[model samples]
Target: MSVHILIIDDEMNWIKTFSDILIDYQVCDAEDIFNATNLSDACEVLRNNAIDILFLDLNLGCESGQDAIQGLRAEFPNSTLVVMSGVTTGSIPLMCMERGAYDYLPKAMSTDELVLSIQKVISRVEHFDRVRFAPNDLSMVNTQLPFSSYVTQDEKLHSVFEYLKVVSMTQHPILITGESGVGKGVLAKAIAEYSRPNGPFVSLNVAGLDEQMFSDTLFGHTKGAYTNASSQRTGMIAKANGGTLFLDEIGDLSLSQQIKLLYFTQSGEYQRIGSDLIETSDAKIVFATNQNLIELIELGKFRKDLFYRLNTHHINIPPLRQRIGDIPLLIKKFVHQAAEDYAINVPHISDGLIELLKSYCYPGNVRELSSIVYNAVLKSDGQVLTFSDFEFPEIRDIESCSLNAEPETNDTSFKRLDDLFDEKIIDALRVSDGNQSKAASLLGVSQSTISRRLKKLQI
Candidate 1:
């Protein structure tokens, strides 16, 4: 794809030569090549042109290129950041990465190296552009939603969807992991829908089950096998024949339970309780966990063999706080759905309310967001929903407390901390002309930290 590229260097000759080569290669037109001499000039250029790639020289007179990485990243999040330097030795590249440079390039690059760098940057940016969420009336305008159950506008999640789509071609057992409430179960079902659309999708949460209960639930028990076994009962594996069997909370399984599961996952063979005859199901196995299985393995609580058997393909859902972009779409979808389900007139939502809600870090992820939205809908007594309609434990406690004490004194410290951090974030944003990266630089924090604080403060 033809792209706009900006080159920043103190040497005007280098910029001219580079622009000429890129234009000759048909990578971009003359009008698309923007050149700047330093970080200040580069920022000014960015304000006028949203380039697809930025080639920033490490040495710009007296300025180091590393100084621009974070600010540029914060301002033009979608632009590819490449740091070119004469000195790329020691931990310079690593330092650039920490500051958010996408790639590092040596100044003395051959034509082949230049071409390869351009190709690499182009390829990376193209993937991001393809999967990036475009705003629409409701959700985002993409190829299609991952599934009806998912309400998101996160590029990271979209990348995850792309990966799942590719892996669906194989029948390997899939492992899904995430923090609780990030919707591992929902992701598991989406994987099932994608991979085994024609077959059933069954799920079981095996967190608290014992050996007998686990075995009975997974493998059907024969009649008269136990005191309560008065009739034949089919197991989840049998019920999910020819489809996907999702085992949630796999990390909670005991070592012995892991053995049984490992055997079933390794070979489809299993036997009914009190019956010697072996039975097999054609179900595709899927496992999910919020816990760190690797950590559990280190502690000897989980079987390494079982973990290997289940981790043929892995998907980890990021937490809600990391993908705040989804907040608007999620709010819209949940508001309408809740109104429809409860048979209430839909309340008009405002950008203010959305902004307020977006600031909250949903520890419960999508499920928590849904609950908050549903509760607000139910509590509203007017056409428009407001902050009063929503009840947050942190907010309420924060409203009731004074910030004179330590945070550990009570849950009220959450709001206390917010009150303190929010002031600094807002001040920085104001001083920096509302650029999150500049604000972060002013406050000596990461850009994401500034962004999150602003969101938390609903600024």
Candidate 2:
């Protein structure tokens, strides 16, 4: 599938340069790559042909490209518009996204960024071809692979499920990122089941592995290739051929290992450790990570290009805190699973217990909730699972901290929901030692958001 690109800009030289790179990468031929001086011409080109990507220069001399974004998006919903700007000042990139641009890039970005940007849109275009969902199905829930096995009536997850269902159609790499225990692996398996049900689903955790180990595990070496290579062993990629290969804890991958994985993703080619023989596998790669990749890229711990590559179909699962409404459903599922595992009767859940469970913030997320329920099931001899069955170390710590919270100022005991939230924020701040930036990161929010909350609460 050749990518049809339309570069809408006044600069002839920039179009020439960009089109040349696309040709070099074999994204499309010269004839297929169209150019337009302005949005009108761009719209004409889009209307004339099925343009996969529309690269609009944020500057159009007299015309404001930012102002035209919403109109362009409305007129050409299928064409993915990537807004490029000369001005990289505050909130402009965010504004482009808000205004319906698929991606935003600075005009002065490196050749690498440009290539990655183009690749990102191409990835989406390929996704457009693969995705079978209609627009009306955006709110679809309670169906599909992962959702079929699990139970949830949370409104927030409706969008997540629908998005995943669409993304699962694409053969390109899918990146599932979220806080820990948000079921990234489960979604990856669902992708496999939905996309290629008969194919194998192989998973590998790359948390503690070094470069040599990572390569050896992902790409098997031939017999006698290494010290312990007495027999030839197949790697996860080979094992998952024609299927899905899930790489968990991908954030822990070192910079060098990231480069290797990036290359494999780009080319679908790899060579086993100490073996000159190159191999290719059609294993659909699925990556999961809890770390903030963009921050890691800024800190030079992660590659920017790799980030874009894996972000082809990024599916971010909101943590348990954001979707607390699903606690009852999740609790029910966990309880049944625990009872089935123990070969015991399913204990009754009290409304008071539900309230108590919902009050404590789940730092460990759904995984932690399951552990609590399972452990409680094992301990309880009666018919009901009570509040004593659950563990909330943070709640206990907060209670202790409230005694010393503003000891010199005011005695603010947690009472209302607002107070509980404020206490949570204060606890995060204290844990981060009054560093607002660190506190924001700990709370999984922006520093500005925390600042606003602090000001509003007068804390």
Candidate 3:
């Protein structure tokens, strides 16, 4: 289980001193240490053993340090390569990093600093291994909602998934913000499944909860606390102890309610309704919202202090329109799921239908697309689905607008044409509820084009 490290340097004294430092600091098992005076011997050692970390001296007498990086990387792709040299001029360190070196250290650094650098690399390697290998041993097999079910082929989404995996290992409070139906809640659940698989996962929508209701729901209520309280009750914080407590629609919370929630989060203590006893919870807090909290804070609807507290670790889920590559995969998954739920055969989707689905700006995001697919499948009699089964009201409106327009004839008609153009733009804006991107989709134009027209027309 001990880490294996290889030191490649031509200087015997440097190699001996660094090896002694590593061994004395218990960086890894002393027997696991390997040394090579040049790239040839280093490659041979790499071929024979798996080196977790490789310390390569860039200034090897007659040899160039940069020349060895590619060869070492080719042979030991998994090893964390650290370039060290007495020469600190030029872009050597940057070049090493660009060529995939884990870190660069100066040979003049003290032993303590060298130990710290080695420790940092080891920590990162261990974290990566933990996250990478966790899926096999974690409670993923027992959970109904597996991480793989979140259908995404986009590189950005994959990176987001990786970030989520790394952050899930910690108990930091996460604030997830995005447009409605962008799957913030789903991501939160995925985090909980990975981070606290054995513990309970509780959720609550804090939108409509007044101060009293928020308190009763989040901090629990004692017997005879209110008109409907007949017995003792446990709230979400208590129920989610040792696990995750996801609060959806967090932006809708009242300012007073925000203060109370912030107090609980800051102090980890809360008082139940009708009880003077203070209680503490160990639940991991995950908050999500569709609204812009900064705007709300500027408008005095949300507390600034609470916003600062919750903004520590924030993730912005990109909307479906932004990640169009994921549309087809999501469509297929939703269609199959719907077919299974309806006890019918899975319907075949056409390439044309998929293309049409990709063109539209899904304002309601993934949830809207899922609903469209499910409805089409239910209404379809044939095995293969076509565009006829899909009802896009926005598309119809755009078509109607185009069909109703008349051609301008002369210079005298230019004024009328301008008026008509303004009317059409206004109509598109109205159809899209003032969302310029959605309006652009409705008009079959780019968002930038819409913005230019809006500015030119002075609308």
Candidate 4:
């Protein structure tokens, strides 16, 4: 079905221009377009029609657009409202976002930029719809945690999901460890959604935050807390009251900040900066880090006490390279998503392309793979995506080496060496469930050797 877009702007010329742009870009059918010059008309259209997207001009001729944002949001909660204004001061956009606007775009944008903004909002709306109305199949259920958007067919991820379910119900602080771009934040959100569905999920990246910033951001400052502090600010913990406070990149917290966080974790109380009164928050803490906390603890970079408190429930997400079978599934999802975002036909993924992707060790994990697919789709001219479409440097290097390298002098010895090491490595990896360390131990080889062979053999 074509998406219905309602454009509310007092300027008839601007409305015509935006309408023409959307029509030319094929954002929606011409018949699906609706326009209103004022708040009353916009409300009437919203009440009568199921508008998929609403573009509201922040400055109506005589009406204050901000006044209508909350009302419209309350009336049409499903419609994705995008606020547009000529004001470039940035505060208006932030205010609009705080008032539940899906996005804010400068009214001076080119047609392409405007279309891109609309497309982004549409994609988000569609994603939320899919998540809300996902299949009720028993097989799709995690069976441990409540249903979430994090889908996986891999057994390792399924085990993680199960563990997340058990940990979600507890108030204990959780530590989720994984490589960067392995969806640590996504898992944290899933945990929050499962445990405190109705409460706010407040996230703060503690990396690069100094002691003062850390304390102020987490345990917000009261009025007159500092020279620049003119008003009171609620900290993440208080904002996440009765919900989950997700502290990402916790490994970067300094020793002093760690001590403060540990105190809060143990006592569930904190005082705002420059405040005499102490406040308490019932926010569940969830911490995630790509860094090795144990190593940091040993190095005296991370406090042992804080580590113990955070690891009351620990989960390690396996890297994408270890779950090769999920590569095709993730590619398929990303391809369809990219197609929808670009307003183009979904490109087909060939088996050769899938095999090529599966062979490479994705150091950046699932996020890197998604980027590869999206970039390929952007460059694709045909329906089918082949191996050449992917721009992975590692794969190209391995191929170049194989084709250009000189032949071995002892062909028989080379053949024997390849068969012996390759077969044993493959067998060991199978037994170890794609764990390189375990595979190396089983084969009595160093982990580095296993890694080198896996790359050399293009496995």
TM-score of each: 0.59, 0.67, 0.58, 0.56
Query: Arrange candidates by TM-score, highest first: which order?
Result: 2, 1, 3, 4
* Pairs in steric clash, model 2: none
* Candidate 3 lDDT for residue 317: 79
**Tens-digit lDDT track for model 3 on 261-293?**
899889889988999999999888999999987
| Model 1 Cα lDDT, one tens digit per residue, 1-459 | 668889999999988888888887877889988998988888888888878999988888999778878988989876888888888565576567547776777878897788887886787667555545424322232346445567667776765676566555455688888878888887778778877889999999999999999999999899999998999889999999989899999899999999888888888989989899899988878788989876687688988667656654677777777777888988998899989888888988766446656666665678888898899889863256755466564442322222232113454445554464575567556666788876665444688887776677676
For model 3 the local lDDT of residue 49 reads 94
Give all candidates' CA lDDT scores: 0.76, 0.77, 0.76, 0.77
Model 3 error, position 374 (Å): 0.5
In angstroms, the error of model 2 at 310 is 0.8
Clashes of each: 1, 0, 0, 0
Model 2, span 280-317: residue lDDT tens? 99988899999988768667888877886887567778
Identify the runs in model 4 with alpha carbons over 4 angstroms from their true place. 1-140, 143-148, 393-459
Candidate with best TM-score? 2
Question: For candidate 1, which ten residues in a row score worst on lDDT?
Answer: 398-407
